[model samples]
Target: MRALVLAILAALAVTGHSATVKAVHAEEREGFKVIVHPDNPARELERGFLRSAFLKKSTEWHGETVRPIDLATRFTVRDRFTTDVIGKTRAQLRSYWNQQIFSGKGVPPPEGESAAAVIAYVLAHRGAVGYLPASVDPGKARVVPVR
Candidate 1:
């Protein structure tokens, strides 16, 4: 049994399956774009502030109510955003939201069914901020720097 397990691990390493999986996920994350309504005056956001906004800890931006948007949990871009930007995995975020709900402190951001929907919401709402795949043209929305 030990030899069988070692052989399987060797095969996986030789085939680079583990590394390939990580590479694919990282490639998918490369095209994510963070955006806000063009009317929003802020050009760039600090990463800490962006995380706070999405986490629903900071409710306002420049004195206006902030409307943070999210993609559905199943989306790859959402996974990347959660992991790379929010510094939390999907499961961690779910747990966080559950705690918030039970405590009556906050709720998760509204989820967009698709990237197009997210962009549309950001463009139409004055205080909206969301992310989309880089392939989408932002139109009047302004891309916010995550860093």
Candidate 2:
């Protein structure tokens, strides 16, 4: 039985499946739920969803709207944060969004540029949400795990 378990573990490692399954935990940010617009069909997201969508899969966000936050700023806000969490740096995200916008493939979310702008935009638009330093105002929106 021990040998069988070891073989299974070895196979999982060799297949690289274990690496893809890394778990993401829920974390608190400023205050809001970090949510999609209530009208959006997306009900819930996993914590790693952003990383998977933007970084790994490069999935175009096609809901009511979406926004990208800076990796460095997010990292400064919390130790648990990662570029992989939001999927890319500010420049990389901007490049991709611009491509989508120009191609008419999709409408990119407005750029917050800074954490404060993110707070303001999210507060004003129920359909928009993005991450900000925990130090910023939380009342602007909700904080939901990206996944």
Candidate 3:
């Protein structure tokens, strides 16, 4: 029985079934809804700015320090946000940040452990920006459209 199970697992691995499973899991996730501190006046953001801000290339927003928060790389919502807005995959991001650290360019934004933590961080910080699963409610926070 053990040998049969191992053989089946090896077959699945050899056939790329794991990638399909991850693809479907990511699709099932609702993706991210961008949220900002309620006091943030900018109602919308340019997508390019998000890429820069998240990368720490643009560090200020409206005279306040840009605090870009993120979900851990394991989350599917994070994958969606990175692909849709940041224009990089998680592995690509890791490589980019690695080079940045090596050259002292900058560091990637901090990551929240959970969706609620992300929302709370946004609410507590003055210039905080983050995302949550689309169905998650960001209490008293503003949803900024990404243009």
Q: What C-alpha RMSD separates each model from the true structure? A: 4.6, 10.8, 5.6
RMSD of 1: 4.6
Ranking by TM-score: 3, 1, 2
Query: Among these predicted structures, which one has the highest TM-score?
Result: 3
Model 2, span 63-144: residue lDDT tens = 3334443323334332234433554545675677688779877654444566666666656655454666546555635656
User: Considering only N, C-alpha and C atoms within 3 Å, which residue pairs clash in candidate 1?
Assistant: none
Clashes in model 3: which pairs? none
* Total clashing pairs in model 1: 0
| Best model per lDDT | 3
- Residues 116-146 of candidate 1 have per-residue lDDT tens digits of 8888899888888999877778777899887
List residue ranges in candidate 1 displaced over 4 A.
1-29
Candidates ranked by lDDT: 3, 1, 2
Error of 1 at 30 (Å): 4.0
Model 1's alpha-carbon lDDT is: 0.85
Q: Write the per-residue lDDT of candidate 3 for residues 1-147, one digit (tens) a residue.
A: 999999999999898997977885766565678999999998899999988888888878888999999998667778788888889877898899999999987877999998888988999987888988888888888899889
| Decoy 3 TM-score against native | 0.82
Higher-scoring candidate on TM-score, 1 or 3: 3
Evaluate model 2: give its TM-score.
Answer: 0.41
